[model samples]
Target chain A: MSDLLERLRGRGWRLTAQRRVIAEVLDGEHVHYTADEVHALAVARLPEISRASVYNTLGELVALGEVLEVTTEGGRAKRYDPNAHRPHQHLVCSGCGTMRDVHLVTDPMGALPEGERFGFTVSGVTVTYYGRCPECGSRA
Target chain B: MSDLLERLRGRGWRLTAQRRVIAEVLDGEHVHYTADEVHALAVARLPEISRASVYNTLGELVALGEVLEVTTEGGRAKRYDPNAHRPHQHLVCSGCGTMRDVHLVTDPMGALPEGERFGFTVSGVTVTYYGRCPECGSRA
Candidate 1:
């Protein structure tokens, strides 16, 4: 059983076969899939799973704060991130849009000086590292 | 004349009446507007301008590297950033989605260790700070 499914079940969320399969597909570190991709994976697991079901389940997970919708690249489809409990950032490949979870040495929120805050009450930070993966680098 | 307009002119970009109005609306240090917002502003300036024109112009500017498309909020509409030449990150309001350009003291790319890079040749980094602006904070 995936941590996501376990968490959902703990929250008294009714896990239908569709929802369960969707959660299972999203189980792992560095797992980020767009809605369509999630639908495809869920379909592979349960051939009867519908695209609308995947989208709705994904939306529910995001609304429940169990998943994160991430738009790594501008004008690109948003990716659903299942590693919501962990505190980490993303390393995105510029060439292929592949993403991986990366723990940073320093918390970016701490790096902002008071002078740069511009009168806003600061809370959190997101740091995205852009690069070429080994495959893309080798190709280049 | 705005820097963006001047740069576009320098590059021999045709400054039609519609394009000029759109460019003028986008001129600022922290300007980040979605296509709909940009269209609204452009309509205020030139009532005859169409939404498609604004989208097309924004696309061309992005392709020319004269503008940047930024997504401050996950699953939200992308914002067009005119300050593409400057090196900076974004400070976004979690409550209202307001965003401002912010400069950090340390370079984040330098903080990633070689072992943690996971075989990716990291090149750049984007750091986004999330918080509530004064208006939203006051309401809270």
Candidate 2:
């Protein structure tokens, strides 16, 4: 994802070894890693990367919309989903917390009628599908 | 929500002062409170309940399907939505984190095609509509 790094440079993001490593770890399709996972992976690549740095880098990426934060469960670690080239939703395995990206053919925004808008400038909608994954379902 | 308590009792949930107070706090329609908010309100009523009790009670409620834990935003404190008699989705305020209940006219499960089920038995779907509420929008 060097192109991502290059795009960041255009946004005036200060390039650092840790930020670059974190970005590299998060690069790729359907790559969803939690903060701790990102930190552990980055630490493996760079021995000196700090936890705070990883958090900061992730925060910056999310703020810039280069990364999407997906919280599928209650009060649990948030999984960072690499924003793919297109808009998508998440299907999560309730048994093991596994998540996959799925693009719904139906637009969810239309589901909310105008009467339900509640007068707030609507930003968008987030839908999470919960179910048992194949492995989890079979195990039971 | 005496019916909730009665159901819990039928399910063999031990009735404690703390659990009862927490249940009372959450015993209404459109009730969504964070852990801290629940604690504050419970203390106002019962004065001696610990934060741990609040947490433990909430956790037990969710585990029993007596309550629904809602994490609308990534990495933010989870808000507990008291499950109304009828199931509904949430409309959240992006600015103040205020949430309201809304029923969708369309069936969300139908939105997902058979191709996307991915061999998992689908359980349910949660939709969170976000925007500025009237107060927040007016202030801006």
Candidate 3:
């Protein structure tokens, strides 16, 4: 968290209380929260924080490469993940909206042959799979 | 196009002129267009088509499992591809916004081990790779 704060300060961002609270809310492992969710959490710490500030802070974090934006189907509100420097995919629970990170050492992009690439330079690939978790499956 | 219309009719969708124009606009190989782009082309054929109807028709077609909705980075408008029944990923041209289909027989979900799966039942995976096209690379 301190490292993130230092990086933000190095980038000339104002170290305001709202930004600090947002950064703290985003810290820790396996945390992915939508802007509204983040706002709700941030409000618990800093009551004066506005939704627009939370949105702006999240957008700025994404632009600074400190966060990632996950957009799912149905045009759901985009979720923010602070673990941007890592290479991982998400396993989203279909029944409960729980998300977990899955890391793979193998390069999935290498599986696509040059002939099949259709002249486009392949850069990166993201894979997301949705299904009910064990709890949800048991309930079903 | 006739087959598509027949299949849609079999699904009990109304055979309106606007729907016909939208279907025609989506015809041909390697076509991926947003709703507005589809609407623009549909209007060229049928001048009275409304944007709302285009959105409505696209949503319905997606719901019917006849079209794929692509949401990528750069806030590019969602693009629809008529080739929904086929299993494929996308190789998108960063320079021109062109998209081509790439098929890989390997299961993407298999890439993640059971330990990494986190108890979520993974249903499907969508992969999109961004890169400069041949023409764009040559220009550069």
Which candidate has the top score in DockQ? 2
* DockQ of each candidate relative to the true complex: 0.77, 0.78, 0.57
Ranking by TM-score: 2, 1, 3
Candidate 2 or 1, higher DockQ: 2
**Top lDDT hit:** 2
Query: Per-residue lDDT for A1-140 in model 2, tens only?
Result: 79999999999989999999999999877788999999999999998999999888888888888888888764289888877457899999888888888889899888888887777677778999998899998454
Put down candidate 3 lDDT per residue, A1-140, tens digits, no spaces. Answer: 77999988998989999999999999988898989999999999999899999989898998888999886544456788888887888777767777888886567887688789876667777777677787788454
What's the best-to-worst order under DockQ? 2, 1, 3
Q: Which residue pairs overlap in candidate 2's backbone?
A: none
Task: Give per-residue CA lDDT, model 3, range B10-80, as digits (tens).
Answer: 87878999899999999987889988899999999999999999999999988888888887665448899
TM-scores for all predictions: 0.91, 0.93, 0.89
Model 1 chain A weakest 10-residue run by lDDT? A69-78
Question: Per-residue alpha-carbon lDDT of model 2 for B60-119, expressed as tens digits?
Answer: 988888788888774278889877457788888877887888888898888889898889
User: lDDT per residue, candidate 1, B1-140, as tens digits?
Assistant: 27777878889988899999988888877888999999999999899999999999999999998888887656378888888877888898887888888888888887677777889988888888988898789554
Candidate 3 stretches greater than 4 Å from native: A138-140, B134-140
Kindly report which residue stretches of model 2 are placed more than 4 angstroms away from their true locations once superposed: A138-140, B138-140
* Model 1, C-alpha of A44: deviation from truth (Å): 1.6
